[model samples]
Target: MRLGPGMDYAVAEFPVPEPAPGQVLVEMAYASVCGSDVHLVDPDFHRPEMVGSPGYPGHEGVGRVVASRADGIEPGAVVLTVPSGRFGGCFAEYQALDAGSVIPLREGDDLPHVLMAQQLGCTIAALAKYWREGMRSAAVIGLGSAGQFFVQLLRARGVEVFASDVDAARIAFGREAGARAVHADELAATVAQAHPEGVDLVIEAAGLDATRALAIELVRVRGVVGNFGYPEFQVGTFPTMAAFRKAATVEWFSNAQGEPGQWCFHEALDAIRTGAIEVGHMTEVRMGLEDVPRALAITAAHGEGAAKITIAIRPESAIFEGS
Candidate 1:
């Protein structure tokens, strides 16, 4: 399929390849639509490609290792593979993965299933970057999949968390995910009332310009503001002077850096497996590969109804028929 501008996807037949040394072939079972995928689909964020060359785009995918040149990852092993920006092809039925980048999934492992690994990893990395000792209050702006995950992480760490979103449905979802849900318009007042001295941490997962500024304003002195959302191709202005004066640390997290080199995936997996984070609410939508294009559009246009949209690639008969 071609992820070209104005063309969300176009089917093309191709031959399946064998895994090379130290690599594995994953028959993808599920792939989640990330905020970055939406950005890539925007014309403003468009990048030129080399003539006649194909670029595969996808990072968050879960599947079973159907074939491998490595030892422990033999056939039928469920795993999560980290494909680099250019050659990472998770949107397809079969994805070639480097052995080192694959994390094995045990049989009946509820924690590391297709629905949990990718988002959990990203959330864990963001939390690790901004979490602090003695921090007791947090506000998560934007209750998308990431924001919901942040709410769970904060609450798990014993912090009082409030979640805000323009969409009421999203706010309700946040509440179900264990956050004190509030609307965007009421966020400033909510934070002010909850913390009085300002919240200890403000996680800007909304990617809106207004929310970005609010994150800076709502954070307490010496508090941390972590920006984890991928806003559309646009720059946002914030109260830099106030943030500086308050000694607030504004950190921008990109999952682009979290593949194999960084422990983003592993950290998220550990958090999910240990119950330090919750993924049940995040997997709100499930569809098959045929729904990829529409799923992307729905996520891009109206993200209020979903936390995470999982794309199932394998049939139930193939994975657990006889068992």
Candidate 2:
């Protein structure tokens, strides 16, 4: 699927590329539609790489190394691929990526389970950077994929999480993930009732003007406000008067930081493998490659109870199992 400006997309059949030296050709099994992919289609939001130029617009997936011109990654190994750059994308039959960008999957790894490594890795990186010790509570606005994972991560670290979302299913999922879930309208009042001084940290995962403002409003004086969602348009005023009055620390994170071998991706992988993190509620929709354009449209509209939608590129039998 090729993505262009303003809801433009098409499925174009093309010959798969041969892997260059130090790279591997992967037969993509599953690819998750990211929030950024939805933003790239907005007419007003001009994504530099996607606007005007038609390119594949996906970054998270798992596949088998069909052909390896690399030293470390072996053929027949199931690996997680984080696609970036002009040529990198996984919403297709096959993808060629640098070996360093691919992480070998272990035996007993379920396809859907490992599909969350990149997304969870992103949350892990951000929380690791700003999550403070002795912080007892947090308010995570927007119980989407990132927010759902945030609730679990915070609770695992011994922080009480006050989660809110417009969707009832999401609120239920948040509660299942160990958060005190409430409706968006009741978030402030609920948090205030729990901690009169406000939560120690406020995470804006909804990526909307109201949610952003709510994050600032719900944080205690000198507390941290972490913006995890990427909105297509401008959200709230940056460092507004209210934020200034509270003197809250505002931090923004989009990419998953830290070394692949050390933090983030590795940490997320370990957590998922050990059952420390559960993503059953994250990928709310599942489709196939032929449904990519439709899936993008639904995700862009935030419709059909969709949070994280995954494209099953190949049949399960075709996906190589680590043997």
Q: In model 1, where do residues sit more than 4 Å from their true spots?
A: 1-8, 46-56, 84-87, 110-114, 234-236, 255-264, 270-276, 320-323
lDDT of 1 by residue, 1-323 (tens): 23554554533545676789988988776677776666665555544451122214556777777778987778878777765443456667887778876787656656224446666677777788788889988999988878888887788778889889878778887887788898889988987887778998999987777788889899999999998857546655778898899999899876544445557776776667776676765665777777766777777765657766777767645654322
lDDT of 2 at 75: 88
lDDT of each: 0.72, 0.79
lDDT (10s digit) by residue, model 2, range 53-145: 323667788989989999977889898887552234788888888887888888778888789988888888888767887899999998777
Once superposed on the true structure, which residue ranges of model 2 sit more than 4 Å away at CA? 1-7, 44-55, 85-88, 234-236, 257-262, 321-323
Clash count, one per candidate = 0, 0
Best-fitting candidate, scored by TM-score: 2
Clashes of 1: 0
